[model samples]
Target chain A: MPDKTAPDAARRSQRSRQAICEAALSLVGETGYDKLTIEGIAARAGVGKQTIYRWWPSKGAVLLDAFTETMEAGEGTLPDTGDLATDLKAVLRATVDEFNDPAFQAPYRALYVAMVNDSEVSAGFTSKVMEPGTQAYVDRIRAAQDAGEVSEDIDPRLAAELILGPFAQRWLLRSQPLTHEFADSLVDMALTGLRPRNPRA
Target chain B: MPDKTAPDAARRSQRSRQAICEAALSLVGETGYDKLTIEGIAARAGVGKQTIYRWWPSKGAVLLDAFTETMEAGEGTLPDTGDLATDLKAVLRATVDEFNDPAFQAPYRALYVAMVNDSEVSAGFTSKVMEPGTQAYVDRIRAAQDAGEVSEDIDPRLAAELILGPFAQRWLLRSQPLTHEFADSLVDMALTGLRPRNPRA
Candidate 1:
């Protein structure tokens, strides 16, 4: 038989984690990352500072978790429909929508700012948030290659970088608006190069 | 004969501008952009806060000027060699060197952080710092198209974005070391798509 105390303990732990994440996001959004403090987050979440420290090493880590959670809630997973074009377009369009959200903007901005200011944060942020998406793209490209849809000589990792790099550049720099049309065009460009072969000669 | 006081006044103004720029860079390097203030810069430069306010709208403006000045001092202009490959490699190599400089890194990183945090700052930062380099690349690509070196169908602006996007992505995220070799490879990959343009069809 299942233990009643086990369920109660699990629920309490889950509630604590949720409260901590919410407090971290709200603090960073209201006050920039540089100004946010662990004590402030603890007070805001009605938990002790030691509780936050027990779960997370730093405020940057907490914020990273919050940001990752928000992205996952929206479009963190790459959809694989067995069609590379359809899947990539679907993912990129979802990314554009996420980037447009106001709730995501401030904390997203703060996370990148934190990365710029701290090298440790940059490494952690890259490994946590960026690597998963990159790996997923690579997997999709490799599958396409195996199916003889993409060129065999192309490096899947680099190819994925090429597809995602332009969007990241524009989004991070605010060089242009990230729209569904822009995502479509990016997919078009990426797939054109990834097509079975090219005849530009 | 011109009044001697006019030349003296011009020299004094130039001196003040130089001092202010230096102070802004130093302060931002010591304390990240978020903590930097107009008052701090003014005090460091031995000028009144109102003097800085009179010339620039905000601390971001001062940092922008400092960054532009640093770029100018290092590589005054983007190369215009007729060959796209040679010219792009030269320009990107110079950029890699600039990014790797200790003096350039902090202020540039600070400005980058500020741009990501504020939309207005992003717009201004792009217009002032990024647009000029992008325009130069566009001109070079246009020249390549006109010379029959590249396909005319390629959008010069988009092509420029493609070439710089990878470097910018890596730099902003601090994902990899920005080296001359990496920059060269990026240029090559962008110019010639991952798939061979003349593969046997």
Candidate 2:
């Protein structure tokens, strides 16, 4: 059994972490990443700046953690119910919904801007957020390959990239609205070749 | 015949425009887009801020012009060699070279960051820059379709999107280096589906 004091401390730590994350995200959103500072986050969260520094290395780190935490709260993981198409579509739909949410939009925009502008921030974001999210998809693709649902020769990493690339491009470029139907069409286009498969042609 | 005075005035105007574009690109490279200003660009280019304002609406516009001008200096059209593989590889290789150029990187990065953070800037970028570049690819794909190089039923827009998506994802995300070999592999993977043509049970 877990120690009783440990659970209480863990809960307290989690609360503090959540408060800090929320403060970081909101501050960055209100002011662009260029204007965001640890001092601003600490002041907003009602915590010492040192407390934030102790928990996070930089404002970018805090923003990444905040974004990840928010995504986790929204049924984050890729679903695996033994059907590749169903699983991919379900997770991608959730992602589209998240992308469309006003609350998620601001921080995501800030983080994306920071990622492109700052090399340190980009490294941190790729490792902390993008890598894990992409890994989940790769894992799903690999599972499908093992089950003979997908071509075994496909490079899982490249396949995951192909699967997610169109949506990411649209979202980041603001080329179009990210919608469930758009996600569905992207998945359909990717799974079946652009050439009509006589099956669906 | 054209009027001699009109030709001379056109030449002078073109020279001034080129100087302003150089100043904007160089200043943004050194100071970044957020710190870049019309005043600084004017001072650096030895022109009045009004001159810049007369030609462009914002710093974003100037940078976009600079980026487009740089891109156009090379093979400005998507290749339509009637062979999809040859055409795509040539274009992708050229793009890889451009993306890897140091002169092109900073201003592109600044514009990309600005696009993500500012909605109006993004829309302007999409219309003025992305749309034309993407259309070039679409035209090439359409040509390939017409020549029986690609499947006629393939959606040109989606096909172009898929081809460009991976490269954009890599460059913007900074997840990996953009290289000619990598571009070649992308073309190969994208054209030939990831699945083996023949699978052994």
Candidate 3:
């Protein structure tokens, strides 16, 4: 039989890890990335700074882990209801809502900015967050193509970018408001090209 | 006659301003933004630290001015060769080249990261760089619509985003290569809707 002490210790370590992730997210959201510290995260989580340092190399790694855990816990495949435009719009609209959430804005932007300058941070974010996220959309687009909705000539990965790119750009630049209406427009334009549909054809 | 001394002073000040902007760009390119300092820029430009501080509030502002001047000096309306696809592809391919250029990468990423946390930097960049750049595309799209190549029902601004957004996303996330081939695919997919063209329509 497995040792009872081993199981108990594993549980405690897991609990500590979760608490540290929560604290890192909370502190970055409240004070932003520049002011965040390992000590502050430790104090908030009631763990020693040594514990944090032992588990993670830096505050950026802690935050990346926090975001990755939070995302994975709630991650679901993109919805597919046979109707391509309807499904894509649902996903984009939900994303817009997430981007606008007060709890998500500061911490998300903090990680985003960090990744811009830090190669390690960028690599971690790309592997842990971006790849999985892009894969979901790619799967959805492939399904649509199989259903005879999207053209076979299109690359599903690039098609996914066409659908998702506008929202990312607008959000990053704050060029304009991200509304459900904007999401709908993107889905429509992406599905139906800029060429005027030939009514008589 | 106008005071010759006043004109001479104005010429000297203009020369100093150009030197400072050039120095700021070159230093940021070589050392990256984190190591850049006003004193460094002044020393490189052969000007006093007081001159840099007197003109700009922060390094971010100085960088913004430098970028804006560089872009404006070369700013031209997007080409409208009547073939929308060819024109857009040319513009995007050139952008791909610019993004991949060694000299453009570090300082551009620096300003991009700075704008994430600094609202003042964001506003300055939006007004000075983004707005003018976007407008060029908007004008080209408008011209295309008038020429009957694109659908009149399309919003020039939104359509512009559809074409530009994918490039921005791929570049920022570093998810894939931003090649001329990728630029061509974006134009093709964007021009022809994802739906397979009805051959007998």
Question: Which one wins on lDDT?
Answer: 3
Candidate ranking (TM-score, best to worst)? 3, 1, 2
Clashing pairs in 2: none
Every model's TM-score on chain B? 0.85, 0.82, 0.89
Model 1 chain B is weakest, by summed lDDT over 10 consecutive residues, at B71-80
Q: Candidate 1's residue-wise lDDT over A1-201, tens digit each?
A: 877998898898789889999998988889876578899999999999998998888787788887777665433346667778888888889889988886787788788887887777888889888888788888888887787667777778777877888888888887878899888777666555312232354
After superposition of all CA atoms, the RMSD between model 1 and the true structure is: 4.0
Q: What's the TM-score of every candidate structure?
A: 0.83, 0.82, 0.89
Off by over 4 Å in 1: A1-17, A30-43, A47-58, A71-77, A80-83, A191-201, B1-14, B34-43, B48-58, B73-81, B196-201
Q: Is candidate 2 or candidate 3 better by DockQ?
A: 3
* lDDT of each residue in B1-201, candidate 1, tens digit only: 778998998899889989999999999889877679989999999999998888888787788877777665333245667777888898899889988887888998998877776667778789878888788888778877787766656677777777778777888777778899888777766666644454456
After superposition of all CA atoms, the RMSD between model 2 and the true structure is 4.8
For residues A148-181, what per-residue lDDT tens digits would candidate 3 score against the true structure? Answer: 8888888998888998888887988887999999
> Interface-residue RMSD per candidate?
3.5, 2.3, 1.3
Tell me the spans in candidate 3 whose CA falls farther than 4 Å from its real position.
Answer: A1-16, A37-51, A72-74, A199-201, B1-20, B34-51, B72-74, B199-201
Give the least accurate 10-residue stretch of model 2 chain A, judged by summed lDDT: A192-201
